[model samples]
Target: MIAKLLSATALACLATISSTASAQSGSGQKAPTANPAQPQSQPNPPSSKPEQQPTSKQPTADRSKLIEEAVTAVRETRNAVRAIDQNKPADAISALERATGKLEIVLARTPDLALAPIDDAVITYDVIGTVQDVERIRAAAKAAFDRGRMQEARRLMDGLASETVLSVTNMPLGTYPAALKEAAALLHQGKPQDAKRVLETALNTFVVTRTIMPLPLARAQSAIEEGRTLMEKSNRTDAESVRLGSLLARARDQLRLGQALGYATEKEMSDLVRAVEDMERRTSGKQQARGMVEPTRPMFDAANKASQPPKSN
Candidate 1:
């Protein structure tokens, strides 16, 4: 009876043990999952960090290429000017228009050129004078045509065509500092013409005021007008005549300088010359001439035109 009791107790203990083992196995099959928001723990090697990519260089501008293109355009313009001078108006006009288009493209792309080292003053003056000359040529052409001067009108038109090209001839090179450096080298090499061409290109790169005369010419004109007004308004005397003579002499000097610099147009210079001649007659004679205003009026008109800024087209 004691042996039977011992066997029954052992079976009960075995059954409890088996039930516990089954529960543990079932729980083991259902593994714990990682939270979606949390990062899975990673095993990293000792002293190891993330790898880095190499830095890339930024793209640089090709200023030399830009300057070369500009120089080529200027040479084309110079050639076009020569064509115009040869009296091929139609061909010259077409060439000039093309040259201008090329220059405008260069100018539009390069804003740094304005601050670049160059002769901005002389270049600006040259361009403006050329532009103004072109306008005057157009007017002169019409006037010549009206007065039955066909040859004169044709010549004026051709001149206008040439001026159009000349106005923009050296523009691109003028704006680039490197071009000036190259020009300096050419000068040192004794290629003055080549150096001159380079400088011209640099000067022609930008346009400024087209109507305002160069400072010296403008000042001289003012002096002449002031003297004329004083002569006409005040009492005529030897001292007054001498004063007027001094003023005329000063004006002549200025005009001469302007001519030397190729600033004033032939017609403009002629008008000034006429005024000076009339003033000389007045200053040298006993009394102021009755027809002095006639010659001087044209001179004043020319001066006035030079002083005023060009109207926008």
Candidate 2:
């Protein structure tokens, strides 16, 4: 069976970009280098203080091992398909039996698992543009789409986001075992063609999911965290205050960007802005705004989590 892969670039083109005009009043033009196809930065842990160009970490070792353990079954399944193509019914059934047995071994160890993760990919749409730019592109795309200019619409939408996409592929446990049994039954009934179809269909039954994370929100979160660290520095000076203000200001800008890009509502963003302002006031002349940022953190965390949509292409 051929692998179904969603490379970073492929994911962006296939997935619909979330865009709507919600530019905040007096929003400054802070275009981030004008390229929407840059690689994503790695997300830092909550306690991390340094600047990080967030990288999507590889699937954890446990998941990698799990998928590796399931490969024998996948390979045997492929062998069964090959046997069917070669018209060797006996070989095909033997391959399938071996495949099924291997799958059983894998499942027996992890009975509670539903879908076994097979593969994953990361997509970064690092668009560098202001809110107005997004609005203009979105409007144009919508107009073109309405007029049935699909190509034009797609072109307009090609680089229309500032976010990261995570795609996971999983093998369905509930239906796959049953499917294998059914295919085996069909083969025993002298229906090699039907059994082959079943096998092929089952091979392609892997499920995929995508989670969209707004980079703007992530940036906002990062900015606040960095600012928090700055506040903890000994004897905060005037220069430190200026940097703190800039960090707060950047967080506000990113929040506005997130709202404009449809990751969050205007009301939600406005409330967040006020929250940032409150933090700003607390840190104006103080050497410790550490606790100040903490109060607004949960709100930022909640908003960022809400902005992510569990969608797929």
Candidate 3:
């Protein structure tokens, strides 16, 4: 009975030992599988910070190119003026068109260019002048009494005249409108040659008003009208005796106009004075040439004549 009991105890011990070994092997296999899942939960290494990008700026080079193009256009316009003076109308027109194209480009690239305002004014003046010249030529080419051409010419003249009047009238309160009105009236009356003369005088008056300090441009217009009346009377066949008188009257009117312009405003009178001087100088030269006087003598006489007092109206 004691031996059987001891054998039973040994068998029990072996069974327990076998069970413990099996449990240890299962735990070892489960640990590896659990480790892989733990790896998924492990936080990823911190990501590196993203780099920044750069920004763009305005192009100075583009601005310079735009300015250069504008300057080139101005030069081309001057060339066109020269061509017009030489009576090459077709060439002048072509050059002016090219200049206009370049100016358009300049405006597109740099609308706020500093010289844009002055350029616009110049363009308006030049284009109007050209339009007037072309219309005058077309009218002259038309058959006499061709109502259609005459009407077309008159229409164009009216538009230019209205524009001129409006330009002057829109100026500051002190600016004169009389000269502009007179020029418009002359153009409307189908007197383009007379209108051109009036317009020239008006331009001078405008310049003078900006410079001198007393006489208004309206006064100059009145003087020009008086001169025109005298000129018309001198055209009569029986007016030979009064031709010299008429010429003298016209000279006096111009002198009065110049004097008025000389003292019109309160700005810089130098420009006005220079313009008046140039006109007087040119008129004097023409007169001397007509009298068959020596070039030097006529020039001197002109200078002296311009300095003398003007005759009464």
Q: lDDT for every model?
A: 0.42, 0.65, 0.31
Whole-structure CA lDDT of model 2: 0.65
Candidate 3 residue 74 Cα shift, in angstroms, is 0.8
Superposed by TM-score, candidate 3 places the C-alpha of residue 185 at a distance from the truth, in angstroms, of 21
Pitting candidate 2 against candidate 3, the one with the higher lDDT is: 2
| Top lDDT model | 2
Give candidate 3's error at residue 206 in angstroms.
17
For every candidate, C-alpha RMSD to the true structure in Å = 43.3, 8.5, 49.0
lDDT of 3 by residue, 178-286 (tens): 3334534554565545544543443333210000111122222233333334333323344432443444444344333333222222222233334334433433322
Structural similarity to truth (TM-score) of each candidate: 0.30, 0.75, 0.21
State model 3's lDDT. Answer: 0.31
In model 3, which residue pairs have backbone atoms overlapping below 3 Å? Answer: 212-264, 212-265, 213-263, 213-264, 213-265, 214-263, 214-264
Ranking by TM-score: 2, 1, 3
Better of 1 and 2 by lDDT: 2
Residue pairs with backbone overlap in model 1: 170-201, 171-204, 171-205, 173-202, 174-201, 174-202, 174-203
Residues 1-313 of candidate 2: C-alpha lDDT, one tens digit per residue: 1123543333223222222211100024445332343454433212211111111122344334455656666777788878888989888889889878867865776676676655556555566777777777778888999999999888877766666665556678878877878888888998988998998898898876555567777778788888987776767888888998899889888887777677656677777878878777777775465576777666665665566553344
